[model samples]
Target: MSTKQKRFIPADGLAGLKQNFTKDALSGFLVFLLAMPLSLGIAKASGFPMIFGLVTAIVGGVVVSFIMGSRLSIKGPAAGLIVIASGSVIAMGDGEIGWHLALGVVVVASLLQILFGVFKLGKLADFFPSAAIHGMLAAIGIIIMTKQLHLVLGINPSELKGKEPLELLGMLPSSIMHENAHLAEIGLACLLIMILMSFVKHEKIKKIPAPLIVLAVAIPLGFALHIKTDGEIAGFALVKIGSISEAFKNGLINVDFSGITTHTGIFIQYVILYSLIGSLESLLTAKAVDGMDPFKRKTDYDKDLIGVGIGNTICGILGGLPMISEVARSSANIGYGARTRWANFFHGLFLLIAVLVGVQFIEMIPNVALAAMLIFVGFRLAHPKQILHTLYIGREQLIVFLVTILITISTDLLMGVGSGILLELIINLVNGASLKNTFKTNITLVEEGENYTLNVKDDLVFSNLLGFKKKFQAIPQGKYITINVSEANIVDHSSIVTMNGLVEEYKDGGGKVLVLGFENHRQLSKDPTSTRILKLS
Candidate 1:
């Protein structure tokens, strides 16, 4: 290990815990505050019993915490999986039993994810087009926002299952006439709070959890209006969490395979959806978390995948949502100064404490508040700014992005993604990418005494980045490098973004790296990172 690497960790594994415990514990508490509300919101958005999200968080923070290869990543139910989980429930016919059966599919998927990691297939994420994935996620965000917009406005769209996102969006004006004014006011208040919190200037004020702040006001006001006279809230939906003991007693560890046999086709579909999306999202999030780390430690991607898979399997059997290395919480963990896995474990501990000691308080939080938070998150995902950003990239990229979003909104997740991939291939072929060269890259590396020049040509997109990065990494350490992409006809968002990171690493390691030949190639956007280049014929 380098001296810099050693400086981050102590003598060995557990020994580092003592040095990191205090800061990690403090960070864990803050993350717990953020994760608790998000876990609830994500689960509600996913069409599962909201408690399942907390259960997933507990297992992720505790089990995966001990085993995860990444130091700062905190595992939990991610917003990206809301579509997969909600779609699975709807596919299985949408009921309590349907959700439990979905958990069965999660178990199967988790097992496959473990196998994928064992086979070192984490790089499979690289095969998907970057724009397409972003488009898919943006569609999911639109779906989430459309669904939750009703709750925020206090109008439940008559029947939510199997509705087109456009149809859901059309229901927005209906809420204006029929919405419960009181609840809508609260929801609007929470939404504004979330938006305003982002712009807060003071660091200390910024540290206050936005969701917690919303809940603080919403929960107290719920009683002020006598919303809950008995066990149930009169007009509004309450956050329902059955007893902790009941969670374990739900025949935990017994995964019903009846669905796999009876709905073999649907079961297989869910398995693929859960495993592929979960693994891809987890691997990507872990990589992003590594990039965000102040210590500059790269995570073992395969190892992290295997750990999350194992943890997810346990959560599956326990009737919990599938867990991933949740990106938002992981970023928060790093921001708050977590040094070891104990921070994650402590987060789970705090969540457990919340469940045990503060169940009533959690229940006191209004559903609209949670809905408002999710709606804000959904808007963030599918914001108009993102669409404009995609359009700025290029005609081809914008085509892929819009196609993926429209298809995903019109059809299901699988078909939408499939269509996106197929369209990407057709676009490439139309742009003069030959069949053989499409699969094979044309990179030539030349070395002269004090420097090395890499000549790259043709498609340099996400699909070929694994090979490209491998060759890039093989270059000797501490050597000046020049990457000449002037000859390349196409280069994508993920490739350029990754190459920029590598260039930064090269510069940090006492070696200079230069990227040349982009005077004519148009930059996609004004953003410095939107450097995706393409040759216009």
Candidate 2:
């Protein structure tokens, strides 16, 4: 008889700390190096005092780590939320009062996130089509790039203020022409470092985070060029992190809620954006990190939502920007061999200590360096491969993706996503999906001894995925199972991906599974996960 080796799961809480303290602490320190500059950049781009970004990171790391369900994700301010945060700040008023009013919106949105978790609505993230989500992210990337490019070229902030994304993009040529030579030199150098580091295939060198390298080069260059005391370089060129301890002294009382009454419409708009988008991004990041975990551990997403909500609530009260399970830092944490949530805690603790004692060093970081880093981030999000991959999936998917990006760039995030969903629905119906069953699942389960079968009879699409997943997961583990989708009018990319995941889950639990019914269907593209529709023959 052959014996199967069991997988080792890491301990949790204090025991986990005792077991993996050295490894976790090292990962935390590395993540801290990466997070510090990115957090400052995200905060600056979001129109809040840069120091508040660290505040959000501290709360996310120190407090949320203990409560969050994911073991390895690093929570902090993310580039993804910059658009909504900046918009809220601008819509509320514009300056000190604007930030205060925006804090009120963050509080309400975070409360709603808590409600979402309490009600077990994290599954709602599954309802969004994969293409639409990618489109939304790509749109965000484009927006980030457009707004930050001028900064990278050393254009004056006063000239770029109040300009829309398209307008900013249009001004790029002019900005480049009139760019400050010395500041641009630092920015371009930092951007070059980011680009080069990304292609580093050597494992040890790759482990050194790119942001740290950017800082290493930019800080010295800033001093050599005399950015702080120079007459030519603008005062805003260097980052002003300010005093974190002093900020917190009055931060607790800084939140203003009068915007709820004064700008009622905008208040509601931002609340929806902050809660819905933030929750979606966090859940998605946690899921991605789960896939990357060495032990194949799954996150309790509802619990994670609650934890992140608590973090956001605290950050709001302290006048900080919204936070999420930031993908880059979290990935870096895993890469550095983080063993438990303690890695997140240590990262936050280190940030707290640095701000308390190392404020001067942080303040030396130039704004253009941070902008260069963000521009690199934006490039990754909007990379051409994303578009090519979507096209490789299916022309319909490409259309939906492009539509979402165009509408988002021309209008706003909510409208762009809404339009993408609507267009996807129309495409499904035209492909023979029944409108009545669009959000309803029709899978009949049959059990015989230890053998089980699922007969899918309706369109299997993203809108109805949650119900299908619930039904699929209800089956007893370690049994022989078969799924027949022959009768489904259409099987979308989202449904195909979910079914693949469920099959893996079943197999991992020592169950034998078979999937049938694709024989008479026509795949929309060469991709294995592309949508399928019944052949008309």
Candidate 3:
């Protein structure tokens, strides 16, 4: 999308809405069905009562829909937030009181997210190397798998507690070998159904989200087998989903106002954790969803963050999980013809309706099915293809990726990512990129009647070139774009790659690009346009 047209696409007027409501409502219902199992699964995986996840979706859709800057992006509990939310509870004693304490952390973290938006710091996440981000997330995926795999086998490995994910994973063989055969049958069946359904390439069949199908199969199968809802079979059972009647029994808005004072230490820890991770994830997801919007709209990432902060604050008070712009749901929204934020609102409305009317039926669902769904989610996050994709970028990048993953699994999230950043900086320095070049970007843009020119005076590198992308993306389509790099004495691989990718994209859109200064540079690997132009040469 052209930078000139990046503003939020507002909802259609009444007449326009009348024309599109059917498409929007159908899209919303589909997403609603898809979100139900996910919400329950993510919340269960995140160590919160299942109801909290439902609350997050309700607030995410109803509150964030009105305020978010993206037209079709959905907001709700996500797999990404599982570690932080669960860890927050665990750090505070892992009980009813701990859950209440975590609410305070959400509020503070949300305040910080708003601050980030206000400061227009949405691009800060771009500084992290793509390798590092992927590695850290993959580690998170593995962590999720380890925790949820137990539930999938219908076993509670809670008895074999360990600090690190690997340590806990060590007990997996035992957990599986002696696993509850019956519930494991259900979980494995659900898992296989999900895996196999992905190959059903027909558009209509693909439209049916896999998680819903898991329940369709598992629910009836459970009833048919007369599976006991509560019992320990090899330390596992067809687990109950807890008391649906007790949902919101405490209150619709269950903020523990005194938690800020009572759990100040853990509260502060989570504030930092949630704000950094939540804002990063939300901004990144919004950026991705923007590219997915069939209408070719560009979402305002800063505004979306602000809206998420506001929604998360409300969810915090209401005993809900922290919310973000979820990529999966948002992609489904666009694919299903969501016309506006009304689709998001309707998705939440449907969730509320389902919970209100079908709480009993939903409760009847065995926990193993939800566990299987999360196991699938975990695999997607750390899929082998994704890991290979990173490796294909560069072996150096692979090193960074693996290091980040290893550190994250061994240490904590913050430390793991921090180590990756530091390592990448060291690698850059070793490659002879100057510190000044890494931090400074001096760009000048000139326009001449449907033709535009962007000039760079300093070395262009990842640390500073994000601004360059913002400027470059603003040029209208079908205009001549001359990225006059002639004056820039030095440019790194990242900058060159960015320039090359944009050039190709612009040309594909019937625009023109003239990259002026890279003719003499040394090529980096197989990508001809990716070269290093350093003054030392």
Give TM-scores for every candidate, taking all chains together and pairing residue i with residue i: 0.91, 0.98, 0.90
lDDT at position 72, candidate 1 = 85
Residue 202, candidate 3: alpha-carbon lDDT: 92
Report the lDDT tens digits of candidate 3 across residue range 455-535.
887567667778788899889999998887766655655566567757766786779888776664544445443335543
- Cα lDDT of model 2 by residue, 5-104, tens digit: 3467788989999999999999999999999999999999999999999999999999999999899999999999998999999999888889999999
Task: State each model's CA lDDT, in order.
Answer: 0.81, 0.92, 0.78
Q: Whose TM-score is higher: candidate 1's or candidate 3's?
A: 1
> Quick one: best lDDT, which candidate?
2
- Summing lDDT over every window of 10 consecutive residues in candidate 3, give the lowest-scoring window: 233-242
For residue 36, what is the lDDT in candidate 3?
89
Alpha-carbon deviation at 255 in model 3, angstroms: 2.8
Tell me which residue pairs clash in candidate 1. none
Write down the RMSD of all candidates, one decimal each. Answer: 3.1, 1.5, 3.8
